[model samples]
Target: MADSVQRAFDLAAEDYDRTRRRLVPGFDDFYRAAIDLIQFPHDSQLKVLDLGAGTGLLAAFIAYSFPQARITMVDISSEMLERARARFELAGERFRFEVSDYGVDPIQEKYDAVVSALSIHHLGDDQKRSLFARIHGALNDGGVFVNAEQCRGATPERHRFHHERWITRVRELGVDDRDLAAALDRMKFDRAATLEDQLQWLREAGFRDIDCAYKNLIFAVYRGIK
Candidate 1:
């Protein structure tokens, strides 16, 4: 699985956006909905942190949506971060990038908002739970944490259905069968937990008002207030 994951994204950074654009038609809308779920005040400025910010997809959207906000993009992969930094270079002083691991890092400062997309599922359940606690500690009072993730469905039948749907969607976009198989193999390592479980974790981490704001099969946006 590790080999497959390394191969799938190792040097495929150049084609990331192209592949996603073709495979995920409603990507922008999903991101928009996640951003809209945040109740940012109009008069006050915000410090927004984007974790596992692969290629800055969410960062760019947040920057555009909340121009007054100071945005920080964090990711464990340097190659992905390079692409993300390059993409948002024109945003000038409003953006910053950091290389960090979410579960292990000690979050020193607080943020008004925390966001992540298509990430976090890589971690096991315990790590995810710990990360939620860390995120709760990283936010100021009444701050928000939003995660758009790939979650496990309620039943194995539903999980299989979502997998088939994902395969169909990717195949429709002309992703090579070899790549698709490789991607699926890597995805098998994903210790994805259910949305209900994640919400419970958030609650245990002391976050309030936890809910899912958007969902498409396994993909959903989970939000909570700190």
Candidate 2:
């Protein structure tokens, strides 16, 4: 399953960023809210970890926002990482890449902040919970974790509305059929949990000051502090 997901992403690596903004409703706010949750100073030389950091989009935003932060980006697809590497080629050692399945890989180093965008939903419920615990352990004191991700609606009615809104908005944004079909295929691997369940899992994992920073239908940005 992991390999399948990796292949899907690797195939889409070249054009993923171009299609993302239109495909995702409230894309700007979702990413902005995630960046806003990172409490470090702009000049702070913080160690940052980006989980499932495809094409390093979110990491690039963080780097632009916090220029001195050193980032380690991990992803399951080397092809995706290659794009990220090229994007940050001038950074030298400021940006590092690792190819591994974050679901089971050991995150050996501690970080002052961990950020993920449009990822994590690929894991099953149990894996999500265990990953949350592992994330907490990987954080330093007062470290923050922010995830900008898709979530299942709380009820059947809400789920229907969510899907409808997504379809309407993406179509309105002029998303081409080819990109839309590919995106839907990738979603087959998603195992998104309800926003409520994820917050509970974060609490169980020992995260304090947990908050849903932003939510728009199925898209949400969550924040937690260790």
Candidate 3:
């Protein structure tokens, strides 16, 4: 499963960043909500980890918002991380990369904040719960976990609504048919849990101040404080 995901992303690496904004209809506020919820001041020199960082788009947002942040980006696709490396080339030692399956690998270090975008939903429900616990353990006392993710709806009808609404919105945004088809194909690996379920899992993982900061169709930004 991991190998298949890696291969799919490797093939898309070149076009990932370009289509990202269009593919995600909620691009503007979805990412902004995640960044704005980070409970830190601008000048704090903090350690941040980005799971499934992809081409480091989310990390780029953080770096711009928080200049003193040092980031570690973990992703299963080397091709994607290669793009991320180029994106952060002049940052010197401020950025680090690890190509590993975050699901099976240990976070291994404490961080001030941990963030992920359009990832994590690839994991099964059990895996999501376990990873939430691991994420909780990997954070400092005041650290926060911000997940800008795709989530399932609370019911079957709602789920269909979410899917249809997304397709409609993206087409309205003028994404070409080929690009839209590819995006839908890659989403086959997604195993999204409902927002309520994920919030409960975060609570079980011993996180506090849990909140769904933003929601737009299937897109959401949820946060938890340790």
Candidate 4:
């Protein structure tokens, strides 16, 4: 299942960054809030890790925000990472890339901050919990993990409403049929957890400060500090 999903993303790599703005409502604010919640000195030398960093969209934002940071990005899709590589080519050794499935793969080092965007929902609940534990272990003291993600509604009625509303909004944004179909196909692998359950997992992982920094309908930015 992960392999198929990786292929789907590889196929969409060329247009993934452009389509995200349309598919995700409030795209700017959703990401901006996540960046804002990161409590780090702008000029400090920080080590950051990005998981499932498709096209490096989120990592690009992080690089711009923290010029002194060294970033390592891991993703299952080499094609997607290729785009990220080209995007940050000028950074030289400052930016690094790895090809791996983050859920089952080992995270090699500790980081001052670990972040992921529009990823992790593909994992089952158990994988998500296990990954949270790994993330906690991988962080340096005072490090933080932030996930900007899609989430499932807690109840059937709310789930239906949110899904329908997202469909309507994306259609209103004038998404072409090709892109829409591709996005829907990829969503088939998404195993998004409810907001409450996700927060509980973070707590069990030994994070100190946990909070949903921002949420809009089914999209949210959650953070946990070690």
Candidate 5:
């Protein structure tokens, strides 16, 4: 399943940004909301780690909004990171890129802020929980973690509804039926937890002041302070 998931994104990497930009109309709005909710230090140097930083979408926003921040963009897909690296070439020394699996990456350093978008849903519940703990540990005191995620609905019927809505959305974007089927089939193998459940897991992981800062159906920004 993991190999299949990786392959799907790898195959899509060449056109991922273009396809997403057309399909997900509100992509920038989501990123803006997530960024607005994050609290950073005024005069101190800030280090930010963007997990699952596909194509450097959110990283670009972070760079523009917080020009002084040192940004590390991490993802498991080399192809995606390659594009991300290219996107920030003009920034030069301000940004860094790394190919990493967030679930297994060791914590040698702490960050002032950790952000992810539309990525963590690939992991199962246990992986999600463990990653949250690792993220908490990776933070300096009073640091923040913000995740803009694809969440599961509260019930089976609601899940089906959200699934159908997403299918309709991608279909309208001209994604072929075959690709959409394959994607949905792969998702069926993994467990996507509800927003409430994820918030509870965050609390269990020793994060404080956790909340869902934004939501549009199954997509939400879950944030916490360490």
Candidate 6:
């Protein structure tokens, strides 16, 4: 299952970054809002881990924001990480790349922040809950967890509305029918949970100051401090 998902990401790796903006509604602000939550002195050498760090889109922003950060980018696809490697080639030891399925991997390293974007939504509800707990345990005191994710709506009707809104908006952004079909194909693997359930899971994982920092349609950014 993981291997097939990895293959899917690998297949999409080349065009992933270019099409991302058109595919997602409110792209810039959604990502900027997530970046805002990791409060730190710009020079701090923070230890950061990005789970399922596909093509390093989110990690690139983080690296730019926190220049001295020791970032570990973990994903199930080497193809994706290869792009990440090319993206961060000059960073040298400042960035580390690993191929691992974080949903089931042991994150034993203590990090100042653990972040993921558009990745955890692929996990089952049980997997998400357990992963939340692991993330909390892997954090240092005062560490934070930030997730920029796709979520389900609070109800079935709302889910339908959200779906419609996304479809309409993406089209407006000039994602053609073929591209939209491909995007929908990828979404088949998404196991998005409600924003409410995810917030509760963070709470259960012993996170404080948990909040849905930003939301639009079914896309949301969540932050929690350990």
* Alpha-carbon lDDT, every model: 0.80, 0.93, 0.94, 0.93, 0.81, 0.92
On TM-score, the candidate that comes out on top is: 3
Selected candidate, larger TM-score, 3 vs 5:
3
Provide the TM-score for each candidate, comma-separated: 0.90, 0.98, 0.99, 0.98, 0.89, 0.98
42-152: candidate 1 lDDT, tens digit per residue: 445789889888788888778777779888888777788899889977778788888777657887789999999877888889889999999999999999999989899
Best by lDDT: 3
**For all candidates, what are the clash counts?**
0, 0, 0, 0, 0, 0
After TM-score superposition, the amount by which residue 174's alpha carbon in candidate 2 deviates from its true location, in angstroms, is 1.0
Candidate 5 Cα misplacement greater than 4 A, ranges: 41-44, 170-190
**Residue 226's C-alpha lDDT in candidate 1?**
87
**Comparing 3 and 4 on TM-score, the stronger one:** 3
Off by over 4 Å in 1: 1-8, 42-44, 173-182
For candidate 3, write residues 1-226 as lDDT tens digits.
Answer: 8888899899999999999998888798999999998979988898999999999999999999999999999999999999999999999999999999999899889999999999899999999999999999999999999999999999999999989999999999999999999998999988999999999999999999998889999999999999
lDDT string, candidate 2, 1-226, tens digits: 8988999999999999999999988888989999999988889898999999999999999999999999999999999999999999999999999999999987899999998988899999999999999999999999999999999999988987997899889999999999889888988888899999999999999999999889997899998999
lDDT score, candidate 1: 0.80
Model 1 scores a TM of 0.90
- TM value for model 4: 0.98
Tens-digit lDDT string for candidate 5 (1-226): 5665566667667777766653453667777788876777444478999998979988888877787889899888888899998898888887888887776777567999999988888898989999999999999999999998888998989988987887787777787766666556646645678998999999999999887877766678879999
Weakest ten-residue segment in model 2 by summed lDDT: 159-168
User: Candidate 3 at 106: error in angstroms?
Assistant: 0.8
Taking the tens digit of each residue's C-alpha lDDT, what string does model 4 give over 1-226? 8998899889999999889999999899999988887899899799999999989999999999999999999999999999999999988999999999999998889899999999999999999999999999999999999999999999979877998899889899989888888889889889999999999999999998898988888899999999
